[model samples]
Target: MEFRLIDRIRERTVLARGDVRLGIGDDAALLVPPAGQELAVAIDTLVEGVHFPHGTPPRDIGWKGLAVNLSDLAAMGATPAWALLALTLPRANAACVDGLADGFAQLAQEHAVALVGGDTTRGPFCLSIVVHGFVPPGQALTRAGARAGDAVFVTGTLGGAAGGLRLVQGRLPFDPADEAHRALRARLDRPTPRVRAGLALRGHASACIDVSDGLLADLGHLCAASGVGAQIDPNALPVPSALRGVFGSAAARELALSGGDDYELCFTVPPADVGAMQAALAAVDGKATRIGTIVEGQGVRALGNEPLAAARGGWDHFGL
Candidate 1:
């Protein structure tokens, strides 16, 4: 049964890469990195109900499990190369395995990421993936390079995924068939990793991070790493139409400030280079909204009407 499951996965996802000396069916994967490129690796694990709702589609779970990890690579401005999956199932169910593989392969092929090796076993339902990518030496974006006076920016929209989760939980009322609702749900279920945006920001962004644990939490991390502070203008935040359509301004603002699972890139760029950086990103069809600036302080602070406490709380795995 296990062999059949592995074969089913193998048949579904056959990403080809020349750097892989040996792929699946081996004890381990053999890989060769291109010369002068640094390897960027990221791993994430998702379990039923915690990372996603219990009844979410197996395909979506599979896709999201890999998508979050890829978002990490994207923040580093890396080009994806290979992946390793460790999937645990409640039972050996063929349909679930096939659905999961289809979703994983779909996104892997989109990023040209080769799934080289992995393991599967009977256990609580969980999915873990480790992705490997490459970046040129001294070109990788990091969270420690931010400086005071740098412009703080974010890619794509924010709070849509959190709003979608709220919609799913029935906390936010909306017609399921509404286009905005559907868009929000899609953002939550299958997030688009800002890989191209990150690539374009390479050599331009002083520091970068993917917003996983809400804007405040993740940006706070970047600020701490860079030894600077951030000042955000509440009026300048990019409000997603889906989030605003369902909730009022205050609720939407809270969602945008502290809601988790958005998976958008939050970065800082030197002031002098901001115009060229924004133009480069626009050329790639990446929407970057400047929401704030780095300032000489200790942590993130709000500059407009909203108080600093507005963004003080976010997703904490152990926080009740």
Candidate 2:
């Protein structure tokens, strides 16, 4: 049954990339990295109840499983090339396998990522995916390159995913006819990995990271790595009006600062290079907003000189 499920996934996700000297039917994948390019690889494991809710559609589960790893590659300013999926299922349901394969393939095709190899087993439901992408040597973005006086920027609006989670958990009222709620739910279910924005940022951004955790927490990581501080303009956060409508303005802004799962890119660039970076992202249909400035000090704070409280931090796997 596991072998049959693997066959279904292989059939659905077979993309022919020249770099793949040998693909799925073998003991191991033989891949050729593009010359002079640095390979950026990232892996993530999603468990049923922890990463996603019970009863979430299999298709969405598959997409989110891959999207999260792709976001990691995006942070490195890499172009995705291949993926390996290890899925653990409670039961070998063919319909669920098909849905998962179809969803995973859809996004992989969009990014030209081929599924080269993977494994399957019976266990508690989970998906572990590894994605490999390529970036020019010496040009890949990292969290350590930021400098004092660099501008802190982010791609896309925030807070919608938190609202979506709320809706899904029944913590917030959900009206089927309300487009805003529907949109928020969609954001939670299917995040858009900022691949193009990352590509555009190459040679432009000094440091980069994806907002898988809350912005404040991730930006704090960047600051710690670069030996700098950040002062965020609370009003400058791109909180969608739809989110504000559902959660109210104050709560929405809080969510934007501390909510996880947005999957947008948070990056830093020198003040002098801001216009060029903006233009690069614009050319790729990306929306970037400058929300803060990196400073010589040490942590993250609001523009009012008050530090963000530790209680409102990003998601911690161990709940520490």
Candidate 3:
């Protein structure tokens, strides 16, 4: 079946009050940021063969391109506002592009964000989304604020995506008939960025970052950027029930600790602010579990004061 861009948008897009002005067919979209809010901007690129496996669904690619950028905005506690899309396609196929646009519009409507500007180019299939958001000045979260003795926390579970990826590649023995396997595959295909949780933790978290890389690697980043070290309890890392069968016990722990692309939030808050942080995140139905504490050292250490080792391999731009 062929899908037209405008038709797909009208069929799938849900308009929001803040998503004012014109839409897809207009020469350009017009958006007005709410009063007294500083604009937060982030851009992300997804190359078909590089960022995702070849022939991945166009809808998912569109959603993820925007989702990852939104995750960056979430880390800064920004309220999403506008987006600009830059699409590169090898061919001028309307159906494929429309399917992608449909995915993008679906997410934009759900988050009350609007598509303002973008470009279309000819190349191997690739997507770049530049997302815009708003935050009150002086309240945007950053990685520079974490201090020694602060508690580090993460929302939701980890490792399921990595395990799910393995399943998708036919490397794991997941039963396609099983509902749980399907769910795991879905998680890997389309991750839920914890935008609400990040927004809620804005004033409370001293430092924050979304877990794009594995937990240990990403936390190490926060520590390095903030000039501190961290000690994470292995047991505290959340692993979903569905992943247990796929990765087993020890392997699951490793995946939870080092698996990347979960897109969950990993942040630090002062001990005194813990209660308030918990209360704020509760509204989103997400729990902020204390997994580690910042220290004056140079790197991350595990529960036994030993350097944390990745159960799986680290993410490398070059060949792994």
RMSD of each: 1.8, 1.4, 3.2
What is the Cα-based TM-score of model 3?
0.90
Better of 2 and 3 by TM-score: 2
The residue pairs found clashing in candidate 3 are: none
State which candidate has the highest TM-score: 2
Per-residue accuracy of model 1 over 47-164 as CA lDDT, tens digit each: 8877888788878887888899999999999998999888899899888898899899999999999888888989999988999999999999999999999999999888888888
Q: Mind giving the per-residue lDDT tens digits that candidate 3 earns over 1-320?
A: 11243444444544555445665556666776678889899988888766666767878877888888898998999988788777888877777877787778777877887775666777788888898888999999988788999999999888887777777667776688977787777767688878899889988999999887789888888888899999999998888888887668888888889887788899999999999999999977878779989988778999789998765532344535
lDDT of 2 at 183: 92
Pitting candidate 1 against candidate 3, the one with the higher TM-score is: 1
Residue 129 C-alpha lDDT in model 1: 94
List pairs with backbone clashes in candidate 1: none
Models 1 onward score TM values of 0.95, 0.97, 0.90
**Winning model by lDDT:** 2
How many clashing residue pairs, candidate 2?
A: 0
